[model samples]
Target: MSYAPQKRHSNRAKRWIITIGVFIVVQIIFIAIDGTFLEPSINDSDNVLAKTVRGVLESKLLTERIAPYSFPFFNLFLIVHVVAILIQALGDSISAIFAKR
Candidate 1:
């Protein structure tokens, strides 16, 4: 059996590391922006739709009597966003594994 060169193997490994690092950074930024800004604005009551939506959200059993403007939508958005991110991460990981081969 022939021995594989270590340098080439390490270089290929470095590419995967960089790819994973970039993926993580991008995900963090996406989560931060969604959590910090987009979600709050979506749930804000500057418009009638937002107020109606907030009222409906406040009537839920889990958040009964909670303030309508207290960012309740943040939790809902967070859960959905996290699930979506997980699915996307799973797909990316599978694709990366296949690509490495």
Candidate 2:
């Protein structure tokens, strides 16, 4: 039996591991920023970033009436997840291009 299938599977698994690791790291960073800056600014009526964040959260998948406290966190998670996937794809593409050399 050939080992090509096993190698391919290993590579795919590595890619998933890298992606998930990146996602977790980035999510932690976002949470830190939220706790340090956004959470405090959220109560300040003069804070533009807070206002924009609230507007985006409310306009996208939630409304003020039904919006749970976790909605903003969910939004941040979605954004980070997509960004991690994109980073993984981009890294794979770059590696493949260089591998042809």
TM-scores, one per candidate: 0.35, 0.47
- TM-score quality measure for candidate 1: 0.35
On residues 1-101, what C-alpha lDDT tens digit does candidate 1 reach at each position? 33344554576578657766765685565556543546434447599988887776565632644322335554444445556657766875775577533
lDDT scores of the candidates, listed in order:
0.57, 0.64
Kindly give the stretch of ten consecutive residues in candidate 1 with the minimal lDDT sum.
Answer: 61-70
Q: How many Å off is the CA of 67 in candidate 1? A: 12
lDDT of 2 at 14: 91
